[model samples]
Target: MGVMNELINRQNVETLAQVLGEAAPGSSWGHVAGAAAELDGLSLRARTDRISTALLADIRLMPEPGFPTAARTFRTALGSAGFTGWIIWPVSETAVTLALETGAGPDPAGDFDDCLALLAELTPRLTGEFAIRRLLDRDLERSLRVIQGWTGHPDEHVRRLASEGTRPYLPWAVRVPGIVLAPEATIPLLDALYRDPSDYVRRSVANHLNDVARNAPALVVATAERWLAAPDGNTAPVVRHGLRTLIKNAHPGALLLLGFVPASLAVTGPRLDRKSVALPGELAFDFEISNTGAADARLAVDYVVHYMKANGTTSAKVFKIGALTLAAGETRSVTKRHAFRQMTTRVHHAGVHALELQINGIRHGHTEFQVQV
Candidate 1:
């Protein structure tokens, strides 16, 4: 089995049940074990859902009301699981999440404050990113206040949650409509974390900014420019990564900001090692660049391969080879080999393939080769 499948198997669930039973002597393990066994045939996500449902059924059996007491009870039970690192953390967090979800309902028997507090405690352990989404929808202003406070928290994880949880375009998480409609609302939080001491936090901040850049490119560019104006050794990575998508799209403003300008450049000797190839073959090529301009040229050298699809149409995929600076009359040579090995993600088709060189977003020379089954 794959690593993920092994991690969430029945054995892990039983281990969780055992830990919970140990944590709370009176807690019933038989029911938890029985429910977990039912998850044997389910897929990863389905198993998680089944486990949550099973835990909810068992929590209902406990005498304590849903809110603070029962939730706290579960959190306390997790303590006995020992610090097994991230492997088992999600399993524990899933149980806790079910408890919080059950307790925060309209007829919740638990205290709202207690649920929020438990979420805060769980933030560092397994990330309250998913749980916080519901809270944001319930009360945007209030959730923003809570998240803003977390930005200054001592834990780097909590601080990252503050930015990540509020991302307008957080992947696998529901969109925060308020942030989508008014991205400026997230800027204050981003500002607090743009130069965060933790690379972990700054990376999240960069992704958040990049998400914003999708709908508001100018805003992100302006923010990057401002940050770059007073370049800090730490913030440079964030800025560079945050602008990656834009740079790939060949945004004029982004290229200018990064100093990748167009120059009088020429590419020659675009040759493929094989004029025809089959599956499990390799395509190798070499090319040389000539800087015919008077001034020095900074070039972002890349290549694109136009792969033929089953429908006989073609799609161009770009790959970065290297970068260089060439003084007047300087010449440099680069070579690369790409594998035509079958991939689960891409199916290879037989047809004429086109190859080209791209410098500073401009395509220079072209060559063609053929591929067979």
Candidate 2:
């Protein structure tokens, strides 16, 4: 199992039951205890769902059990010191699930609003990001309208949840189609948050914009441009991260916004140290670039690897090689080493692979090498 999946193992399940058992005495926590036994083969998210299902079943055993009642029980644990860590993931999930299940409890609108508030409060425990997506999926505008206020929240965690939760492609969280369909909806929130004091919150804002850049490059560039016009000391990094996807795709506006404009350059071989590499080996290469034009060139140097896939096709992925400027009639040499190994994120396939250099938004040198299985 992946290390991340192990985060919600038997110990975490038992800890969750112990904490909840303390909050609600007399209720059978056997349902939650069984979650530990059921967790073996499940993925991280599946384990969360399994635990949440158990939590819901245990909560249902209480008299007059409903959204408000369950929320109160959760709140009791929230006040307890043990109500933190990975355990909160299932707790957050349970809160939202119960809220949706019992729509017209004591106060209908307030139930939904309370759930949003509960997530913001719960975020400091672990993260309410994943739970908030279901709320967003239920009512995008209402959720955004409520979350919009979170941008200025005093807690950095709450502020980050504001951006991270609304992200159209938030990793591991269910997609909120409304955010994808109406990409502009979250722009205001990003605008409010790009200059946030906390790096944690600003990073989430950058990722949110990066998600929007997938389909709306122009909007992202325009937003980045505006931020550049009135940039704070940290704005550049935020804009750069936000436009990373567009930058990788060689989007002109994104490059220009980051000062990596078109440039005239004399390029040399991305001379390979070896023409072939073995599995679990390393390949080294060096290259040189000279400013051929009379003007200084600001460059975003990158390298691309055309990796051979299991399907006998090559897929190219870009990797950064650091940025530099070449003055008129100046030249610079660069060397880099790359390792090929099996990883959970990427698998190595033995075949002919290609490497290319990218300067500014243009591709320069191409070299082919072989990988032996």
Candidate 3:
């Protein structure tokens, strides 16, 4: 065996346990050890299902930045230990490793769409959702092409990734740069999968379109209008998920496209008086909205406070306005009382910070205030 392979074989669970215990001082390894031990304890004849749960948890604790190397070592150990059923030679992982080892950007894997094919095949088999997500995040072209292809895949899982992987601001995963940069690309891909036969696939389509809506609202608004007009059973719900917030906030043409079906009424845009509230301070605003439509609406409005740090990056934190479902033609006035507790861990510098209110889906109220810490 090569030296690297030998090294990987040597880095077994026992060694892994010790390194993880000390990998970062005062770092909590927690059940990470137990998870690794469970993998070590698996027998050669162990079913693929046997080691999956433990491996999934254990890999989460695995650090990034050379994570690709550690994964290779993991593969070597698995092979030498005769545990092949669980071995994953992922397009994302292989792509990462290949890039790292060669000190080059990823080359095109089989045709323009090969990466997609591999990722679709591998997403289900892999242990960690985030790792594959990171892989997709790293290779958007390949990932999307593959996902688009999978919209036609016979496997339901592949079809789901087409929608699931492209979510904007998908939690616990890196945001796909391409989708963020050029969200327009996601439209056609979503259209193909919106009516997928699988409910699993349909749910992903809803969430995916919602993801797009969050970042690029108009793109979603326009596409949703087209789908809503079609009135197809498949794309309507998918389009609705994408348009719900826009319709609630009265984004110009959204309601018109929904046949002005008068989707539940909503009130939005609270007016707050002050630019800056002093620490140990409370900010108060009066929020008012009237629903004149026929349908009863479930209304939700919230505040996003943006804190300007010394580094010039704004940190956005969301505060909720409790849920209220509006009755038809009813107008309600509500109060939002926001208390600013000085964050001790991070200090504020003197600067103008931005804050906005999101009602249903539209960002209506805006406050840019100057503050000194």
Report the number of the highest-lDDT candidate: 2
Ranking of candidates on lDDT, top first: 2, 1, 3
**Which residue pairs in candidate 2 have backbone atoms (N, alpha carbon, C) closer than 3 angstroms, thus clashing?**
none
Total backbone collisions for each predicted model: 1, 0, 1
Runs of candidate 1 exceeding 4 Å displacement: 29-31, 38-42, 81-117, 137-141, 167-183
TM-scores for all predictions: 0.83, 0.96, 0.49
Instruction: Encode model 3's per-residue lDDT on 32-110: one tens digit a residue.
Output: 3454434433332231223233333444455542334333444334323232222342214443433333333244343
Q: Candidate 1 vs. truth: CA RMSD?
A: 3.4
Tell me the deviation in Å of residue 34 in model 1: 2.7
Model 2 deviation from the true structure expressed as Cα RMSD, one decimal place: 1.6
| Model 2 collision count | 0
What is the lDDT for 107 in model 2? 80
Ranking the candidates on TM-score from highest down gives 2, 1, 3
